[model samples]
Target: MAQQGPTAPVPVPKAGSTPPVSKPVREGIDLVVNDKLYRHTGDKTMPLLWYLRDELRLTGAKYGCDQGDCGFCTVLVEGKAVASCTTKMEKLAGKRVTTVEGLADGQGKLHPVQQAWIDEDATMCGYCQPGQLMAAVDLLSRQKNPSDADIDKIGNLCRCGSYGRIRKAIKRAAATMKDAKA
Candidate 1:
């Protein structure tokens, strides 16, 4: 073994030392939910539904389909109806979100749409009612005295086939809201 070359020393791990685990860097995200300001510093990829249900404990918006097609997780974001399941937290900065629980007044007076839902007996299983009500609220906010075609555009599905009743309730709620404004 003539002329041995110098070998680089290998770094050895210390005993009882654990490797550092990397956590996702959380950024401050701000939004208003149901007239309350919320500041979240968690995974930015989390959907609004998870923030509402798991973090905020506002469960009125049911989890029917994780995909946006179902409309079961519909909520109002910045006064527009949106599928909460598909709305990521990163997109909600400085936005206002309204859930089904926010439909009632501070004095416990039911929103016209909620009352109409009850008066028209629109619920069969009641699982889809929250999403339906939120969609109706957003629709009525934009369109006054919506036509049958417009009502059909709400797009929230009821497994119980309560379309007729839902339509009637929307009409009634629109009338009630209009009268209240006048």
Candidate 2:
């Protein structure tokens, strides 16, 4: 038998070599994202975290544990705290979604909760502070007089063990908000 030369393998197309040909499926999701009215097209199953972080570029919500054990994905939805990582965007249709960006004032000033965090030097790694501030704001909005237990129940975690500082900032922010209302 004659010796056969080694044949080269055929090249495979790259995973994303071609632009997506399919039309982007459109579904209407009317919600207020970051204080702006938005109409988004995404599957009802799409997680709220992707809508906020990827679509809107609101990167404040950290990915942490997607299972909701870690409070890093916390955000305010309809003035209540929620775990955005596990929340479905479709469920939030016609609702208000408030991320860290929405907490700022018209002049681009930080919310009292965020300002207090900075003043108290609350964050260490800072990965978890966004959620912490969001949760604190939600708590304060409901319970203007949150006790230690009320604050503790919100489950804001800082791996840096800045819980003490966080509590103090929340108290200061509550007082400030109250004073402003007065």
Candidate 3:
């Protein structure tokens, strides 16, 4: 016969104590993107960038640094610029998300920021323009006449070193929007 060893005692429920009940599992998340409603039932932890690019096929928000440091994945969540790479599906329930594709009007009119970018030749590679445009949209929505410091706070990087042109484009867009309002 083999030698027996001491076994640890198993936890037993006390008298009148009931088993712990598990939390109810979440069914899904619902959100609106580009004015269209979306019901997401997959992993709740999925990043908004992946949902937009992979599931929705809205690839305007580019994947730069997945760490959320670069603003390349920036998008408008409730009209506020957010880093989509770090925003999770679980947090966007019933929220409105807007990608660069949604910036154009139904009549095919380009957004002021987009037109300004073209007019100013603000892009070199054009990889970071989507994020820059979204950020600029949010900024302009808040600040009618943004100064150099305000434009600099857009926080999107252009590897093409088009900062000067980008600043000019934002200024142009701001002016155009102001004119449209008046």
The lDDT of each candidate is: 0.86, 0.81, 0.87
Per-residue accuracy of model 2 over 85-177 as CA lDDT, tens digit each: 889977887687889888998797889999989889888999999999999999998989778788889896789998888888898899989
Q: What TM value does model 2 have? A: 0.83
Candidate 2 regions with alpha-carbon error over 4 angstroms: 1-26
The candidate that wins on lDDT is: 3
Candidate 3 error regions (>4 Å): 1-26
* Candidate 2 colliding pairs: none
Top TM-score prediction, candidate number: 3
Regions more than 4 Å wrong, model 1: 1-26
User: Can you rank all candidates by TM-score, best first?
Assistant: 3, 1, 2
Tell me how candidate 2 scores on lDDT.
0.81
**Considering summed lDDT, which 10 consecutive residues are worst modelled in model 3?**
3-12
Q: Write the number of the candidate with greater TM-score, choosing between 1 and 3.
A: 3
lDDT of 3 at 151: 87
Model 3 TM-score (2 dp) = 0.85
